[model samples]
Target: MKKSSFILMSMLLVFTMFVAGCGKSENNNASGETPKTETETPKESEAPKKDVSLRVFSTFGGTDTAREAFQAALDEFTSKNPNIKVENDTMSANDDGFRTKVNTDMTSGNEPDLLFYFVGADAKGFVDAGKVVPLNDILDSDSTWKSGFSPAALENVRQKDGNIYAVPLTGFYEGLFVNKKIFEDNKLELPTDWDKMKTAVQTLSKKGIIPLAAPFDQSHYVIEHFILSAAGSKGHNSGLADGIDPNWEKGYAAMKELYDLGAFPKDAATIDLGMASNYYGEGKAAMILEGSWAMGNWKDPAVLDNTTVIPFPAMPGGVGTGKDVIGGFGSGFYLSKSTFDNADKKDAAIALLKHMTSPAVIEKIALANGGTPAAAGVEIKGKTQTATEGFAMVANADSVNNPIDTMVAPETFSTLRAGVQAVVTGKKTPADVLKEAKDIEDANKK
Candidate 1:
């Protein structure tokens, strides 16, 4: 009997021990403290991450080098981040229609995840509407990225309120692009002054070579250059706001003289910028007054080989000695408030933005597009002689001014554009054009 009692007690003790082990096992499972083995690893959640889609808009479209470079960078980004898909909505870089589309979209509260557009007054409405994300925080947080840009480049995109709203990609300059072969073959000296330019115009016209490939119908480039060259930086910045200055009249008189000398194509009043570019590329025109952006259009080997760029000669009694340039960081990328506000995609969007504006990307764009890189310390090598000369013009400049159209109200710019065209086509005298411009400016001021 005593032995039976001992066996039963032993069985009971064993049962208690088993129960305690089971309880401990259950508690470990419940507490998520499962014992790990030497070779075991924690399992990652099997649930797939939610895919993100981003909508991006840009003015760099069509056959432009900027478009191509942008696409290349975008492609690289997508390759690096396969989870995020980007939808590119692009339009012609030079078209005013893109601005209309963006304005419409913003008004409807359908802003894209990313946008590439002009900075400054052109973007003030969007910025004021609270559609864009102020980039100061992002830039401040990333010292590496912030250091990539020059202070002048950053200042160029700063609004009147002293806040940066965009990331500038390129700097631009305007100058006279000459066909060197044409001048050399004709035994004519390169124009270095106003009198030399006039003589070249007369000589080239007599030789049946279109002296200047000007497109008065659609482009205000030459007109802007002439005005800036005549008025200089100080006069241009101050005069345009105060109504038409007498300097503008002198600029117009010079343009009229060129027109009378048959310096422009016969169809200048009807032709667009494309036709003018074609003439310049084919060596049909001796010169074309254009911005650095136009350098990409002259891809023909002969044209590239023969091209050279120089600042327009200083006009008599003008404020500048042909050393002031119309250039700065004019265009940049703007972030969408919606994108930055989205919790799911904000990080990815910011990462993409940083990638796009990175020094490497800026250098690539500048090299491919032939413009001054907004990012500091980025040098574009292997440039054509024309591009080299363009760079020299910018490097040697004493002052740089924003284009008048960019600095003035839209209505004022429209009037100035139309008035300049009319003066160039002989439809109105310089004084008459200036009067009309001043009236427009005065009305806007009122």
Candidate 2:
């Protein structure tokens, strides 16, 4: 079927399902004629008809793959409710493009009913502008919903004023993706401490294999490797969950040593995440530090299929040893107060939210994308290389440190990312980077 016709049919089916469930209402007098009643009847009004339509804004880029998944989700939601109709407005990948679209919509009083948000400054701005709804009431009224999410996961999306504006969909953990075959082929044991890890990298490098694969084009990934190197050395509880600051000196020192040893590629600074994956998939590198989201793509049957994930190796006398690493909730969903205030629209949107977040939906998304589900005990069909790797890292971690971007204030995020990138790229000394970060934080506070 044509795409437009498909969407229309899906929406129509949804409207039918919802309308079928609600009782119809009519106005009549006690005499059973269509006339104004002498005594107005006092009773609860009937639920509104299920013909309401809501628009959802998203940054999924609307690729055919994403569109198919979204349509499936909407179709399922409508099938269950049969009252609400949801249409999606997908945005482009260009960061400015999305911000422009949202801003335009907000100003024109044509804002969507819901939006997908990335936690931190982006979501904070919307909350500050009163463009997003405070979900505190909904959360408080629904016990099962409130209890379903992990506190750490939920905290990332909560507003500073103790009100929740978004519901997290899932979390992506970052870790080292190791080539198990390489380790076994070299008769090398997996490293559990700092000394062993260094020895392994050096040994593997001597054999003409790059020990670590890092995509340098994405500065954040490069910086995260540095952060993990420190976290692994310092241990997970050293209060260095704060990234790239002066307090994280020990971590920086460790990262610098790895750079000096040439653990990453000769031009690691230029390689993006995809290039890093190619390095590992083609057997040019032994491991890469990446987010769990990468798992889905890495596990594509077309790519190498023998890789496995593990925590960053340990460092002697470090905070939490190699077993402790960093991770947190990756993305979120939010509701608009304007949408919820309309009685017919409100019930329809709420029902959609609940259905899309149900255990079944969570499992499908996880299985399809190879990421972990936010909802507990939801069983998915399969695992991707990245997801399995993420699970391994999570399992090994004595504790998972929050990704700095998820925990720190918005203005500080850019400062933190830049500082870490500077150190990783050898453009700035660790001390210099740390000092700069401190100044930025201090200034933001003022």
lDDT score at residue 37, model 1, on the 0-100 scale = 67
Q: Candidate 1 on 253-306: residue-level lDDT in tens?
A: 888888888889998877877789889988799999777878787768888898
Q: Compose the digit string of candidate 2's lDDT tens values, residues 1-446.
A: 99999999999999987776432323233436654468977779998665878888876553222345555787888776566678877864324357667767765778788777566545655667787788777877988887776666678556558877777766667777777778888887765566666877888888889888874444455455455555543432232235443335666667667767767787776666567766776777877876665554453443346567677765443443556666666566777767777776877777777766666666666665555577766644335544555676676677666555444444455565555556766888777766666566566546
Query: Looking at model 2, which ten-residue stretch has the lowest summed lDDT?
Result: 22-31
RMSD of each: 3.2, 15.8
TM-score of each: 0.90, 0.73
| Candidate 2 off by > 4 Å | 1-53, 59-70, 78-112, 120-122, 143-160, 203-208, 228-247, 299-305, 341-345, 380-389, 409-411
C-alpha lDDT of all candidate models, in order: 0.82, 0.64
Candidate 1 at residue 324, lDDT?
Answer: 76
- Identify the leading candidate in terms of lDDT: 1
